[model samples]
Structures are given as structure tokens and as C-alpha cells.
Target chain A: DVKVTQSSRYLVKRTGEKVFLECVQDMDHENMFWYRQDPGLGLRLIYFSYDVKMKEKGDIPEGYSVSREKKERFSLILESASTNQTSMYLCASTLETGDNQPQHFGDGTRLSIL
Target chain B: SQKIEQNSEALNIQEGKTATLTCNYTNYSPAYLQWYRQDPGRGPVFLLLIRENEKEKRKERLKVTFDTTLKQSLFHITASQPADSATYLCALAPADAGNMLTFGGGTRLMVKP
Candidate 1:
């Protein structure tokens, strides 16, 4: 079975703080993604990395950035946390098998910005 | 202008009955449509995937149908148990190389005993 691990299950941060959410996958998948899920918004992609040091912006990438220094780890950075940034953050990884592969996901980190 | 839409209302059904969920999309062509199951406080889990060339796909008691003309997909669960209750999300992946996905607001399913 594939395992994707997020560093935190729940996190709280004050406004204007820098927050980091970490994710690691054991499957060594080449593609990793960061998404923020809000009520009525579903899962909107924030950023994705196809390979080490390679990143792409998704639908909603404002105020957020990503780092993929290694294959197993992907990190989501909140430049300046705001109350509007509070949402359930998810990390997913998948093999580079063209476009037919299913993404394996972590449990997610519920972020709260006060 | 691309959009993926799923029923936001929770679908309530009796146990041992079949439950169907709907997903619709517009303004974009996807090479693959995928369904995922997400419990409360957990990330979505991949359930099934259907390609644009295929009309239907099944796994165990779960079935999915895709219609490109209508830009809709239906997910069915036969003899559903309470354990089958969860939010189901549908995602559209374009025919391009990357795994870019556009997801819809998931619909929650509640199985009553």
C-alpha cells in the first residue's frame, strides 16, 4: 500500500505568520500536489511539483508557494497567513504514468488562522 | 472558464439500496474522469477512474458511467452499507501530460439503517 504522511493533522497560526505544511510519500511518485479545501469550494489546487525543483501553479496559488527539494517530500508555504487562508490542506502524490494514474493522498492538515 | 459540478446536497438512502451520485462538467474536455471517497477529516481516496473512450467501468459493487455528449458522469453503489456513507468527489483531468485536476464540490451520502 502507498502511504502519504502529512506533518501535522491540525495547526493554528496567528495572522501575518509564516506557516509551513509538510508532506512525505513513501511511493516515490514523481508528481506531488498541494490543495486547499474549503466549504462549498471543493479541492482547489494551490501548487504542484512534477520533479525536484520543478513547480507549477494551480487554480488558486496566491499567498502560497511550494518546495520540492527531494522526491519524497513536498512542502506548502504560506507567505503571510491570514484568516482567509484557514482551510483543510491536502497533499497528494502520483506516478508519472502519463495521465491515467490515480493520486494517493495524505490525511491532510486542518489549518486555522486567527 | 472550466467548471466541475457535483451535487452539494447530501443524498440519504436506506441501507441495502443502491445510491447514485451525479457529476457534471462544462467548458473543458477531459481525457479522464475520476471518483474519490472522502470521510470526514480525511483526504479523498481514489475509488474509480473512467477514460473518455470508455462509457462505463465497474469495481465490485460500484459502477461509474461517463457520457461525453452530456458532460456528465454517474457513480452508483449497489447494496450500500452504512460504511459506504461519505462525501464523493469527481475530478476532471485534461488530455495533457501533467496530472492537473479540476475538482467539483463533493456530494455527501448518508446510508440509513
Candidate 2:
């Protein structure tokens, strides 16, 4: 079975603080993604990495950046956390890019900005 | 802009009944559609996937149907139990897009015993 693990389950940060969310996958998947899920808004992609050190901005990438220095790890960074940035962050990994591959998700990290 | 929409209304059904959820899309043709189940405060779990060329796909009691003509998909859960209560999300990937998925808002289903 494929397993994706997030470094944190819950986090709290003050306004303008920096926040980092880490994710690691054991399946050696080539694609990794970060999304923020909100009620009524659904899951909005923040960033994605297709290979080591390669990144792409998604639909809602503002105020967020991602790092993929290695194949097994992906990190989401909030340069300056704000109250509006509080959300449940999810990390997912897929073996390849296509319709046939299914993404495996981590448990998610609920971030609170005050 | 490409968009996906699912029924926002909550569906309530008694045990042993079949629950159906609808997913509709506009402005883009998807290569495949997928269904996922999510519990409160948890990430979604993959349920099933149906290709544009295929009419339907099933896994045990869960079935999914995709209609390219209407750009719609239906997810059905047969013999639903209380354990089946959760939010169901539908996702679509365009043929030219690489692994990127646009997801609908999702439909909440409650199964009563």
C-alpha cells in the first residue's frame, strides 16, 4: 500500500509569521501536490512538483511557495502567514501523470493563523 | 474557465437504500473522472474512476457512470450503511493536462440506520 505522511497534524501561528508544512511519500511517486480545502470552496491547488527541484503554481498559489529538493519530500511554505491563510492543508502523491494513476493523500494538517 | 459542479444539497437515505450523487462539468472535456469519499477533518480517499470512453465502472457496492455527451457523472452507493455517511467529491482531468485535477464542491450524504 502507498503511504503519504504529513509532518504535522495541527499548527498555530501568529499573523505575519512563517509557516512550513512537510510531506513525505514512500511510494517514490513522481508527482506531488499541495492543496488547501475550505468549506464551500472545495480543494484549491496551491502548488505541485513533478520532479526534484521542479515546481508549478496552481490556481491559488498566492502567498505560498513550495520546495521539492528531493523526490520523496515536498514542503509548503507560507512566506507571511495571515488569518486568511488558515486552512486544512493536504498533500498528495501520484506515480505518474495520467488518467489511470490515482493520488494517495496524507492525513492533512489543520493550520490556524491568529 | 473550466469548472466542475456537484450537488451541494445533502442526501439522506435509510440503510439498505441506494444513494446517488451527481457531478457536472462545463467548458472542458475530461479524459477521466474520479470519485472520492471524505470524512470530516480527514483527507479524501479514492473510490473509483471512469474513463471518458467507458460508460460505467464499479467496485463492490460502489458504481460510477460517466457521460461524455452531457459532461456529467453519477456516483451510486448500493446498500448504504451508516458508515457510508460522508462527503463525496468528483474530480476531472482534461486530456491535455498532466495529472492536474479540478474537483467539484462535493455532495454530503448521510446514511441512517
lDDT of 1 at A106: 95
The collision pairs in model 1 are none
Scored against the true structure, residue B68 in model 1 reaches a CA lDDT of 98
What does fnat come to for each candidate?
0.74, 0.51
lDDT of 1 by residue, B1-113 (tens): 88888999999999999999999999989999999999999999999999999999999999999999999999999999999999999998988846777889999999999
After the best TM-score superposition of candidate 2, give how far the Cα of residue A75 lies from its true spot, in angstroms: 0.2
Worst 10 residues of 1 chain B by lDDT: B94-103
User: What local lDDT does model 1 show for residue A61?
Assistant: 95
Query: Per-residue lDDT tens digits of candidate 2, residues A14-99?
Result: 99998999999999999999999998999999999999999999999999999999999999999999999999999999998445
Per-residue accuracy of model 1 over A70-112 as CA lDDT, tens digit each: 9999999999999999999999999997567888999999999
Best by TM-score: 1
**DockQ top scorer:** 1
